[model samples]
Target: MENISLVIMEKEKDTGFLSRELGSYEVKYDTEYVSSIYASREDENLYVNMYLTVPGEFEDWKYNAILDNYDTGLYKDKALLAEEDEDSYNPGWVIKFLFLENDNEMEEKINELLGIHVSELERVLSQLKNIEDEYRD
Candidate 1:
């Protein structure tokens, strides 16, 4: 039973956006993964992973990946990414939420919101718990 799902997300860099408007770019973050990683916790009660992307940041270096910039405060010149796993490539600013539990409750909720069947969500949850366990322990 896998419950892991991958979604490309973006952050406004907090230039001048509201706190509640951070996670609003839903449609654009749902395509072509620049990079991704997952890890679990010690007791399998916690999970953590990172999402790296070069969304909208179009430069000669870092691979040119065109991301939408409709209402986002980000830009094509500046890059917004992260490096948490130290194993996979750098992740974007937006962090996908991963909770430990095999009930598929989160899956159902995401399906309700995104209207997509992501059995891979379970896969991410399990991977996160495993990776987190290594560092947490």
Candidate 2:
């Protein structure tokens, strides 16, 4: 049996369903192709992967930011900098929950990753129910 199933949620396409509960960050040079949130179930554990990206020119920005928050400030004046070569774009993360025990654990994990309150997590979880099981992977 497959122990994990995940559904990709895009901020642009799923805004109507995800906007109020799921939050997104602003990144310079970002392409819409990056996933917003990935909600998954691993056996009995719940996981939410928050994905992020920067523009190709600022490809290393994500990694730098992860290592030091101060690096993210570069985006404030990024437009003034000379454009860097576009080799490839890489995704970033806020947190990754491997497994969760119950609704309470899910709520806590979601809150930590999304920076939302418990109530918002509750709402997101409820909305997830309407998605069909065909999304499983």
Candidate 3:
């Protein structure tokens, strides 16, 4: 497995009068492929949104397959499949993980989420590679 490194590209702290949001950060994964993360905190909860832009066009069946395979068991509750937008410029899937602000194992939970993200990303890339190999054959 490749070492996963995250770099914060942008950050913002909310100072609104009645807002519960603490801050938000845009993170980029230092990997061969393009991947990014957006994290925000609202009150006692933190939401981490991970996105991997597909190399080419997006396929509905591939999206469904990824959701079926990864979005289950322990990840079922914490990780959710974000809705797709037809009008959006970028075509990719997003998996959102929720964490409690005061949780004692917050770091561990975040690490777990990162692991899942990397695993799922590898799965997607493998499938694409297989398709390319088949075409070459």
Write the residue-wise lDDT of candidate 1 on 1-137 in tens digits.
Answer: 33334432322233422222112122323433335433333343333233444334323222211121111232122212222323433323333345424435533433432222122232333354335434343
Q: lDDT of all the models against the reference?
A: 0.32, 0.36, 0.48
Model 3 shows how many backbone clashes? 0
Query: Can you write out model 3's per-residue Cα lDDT over 19-128, one digit (the tens) per residue?
Result: 33433322233343335555655566556655644444546555444444443344566575553323333444555666445443444554565555567667755675
Q: Which is better, 1 or 2, measured by lDDT?
A: 2
Q: Which ten residues in a row have the lowest lDDT in candidate 1?
A: 63-72
* Candidate 2: residue 103 lDDT (0-100): 48
The lDDT ranking, best first, is: 3, 2, 1
Using TM-score as the measure, what is the rank order of every candidate, best first? 3, 1, 2
Predicted model with the maximum lDDT = 3
TM-score of each model, paired residue for residue: 0.29, 0.28, 0.42
Better of 2 and 3 by lDDT: 3
**So what's the TM-score on candidate 1?**
0.29
Runs in model 1 lying further than 4 Å from the true structure: 1-31, 42-44, 55-57, 60-91, 94-98, 108-137
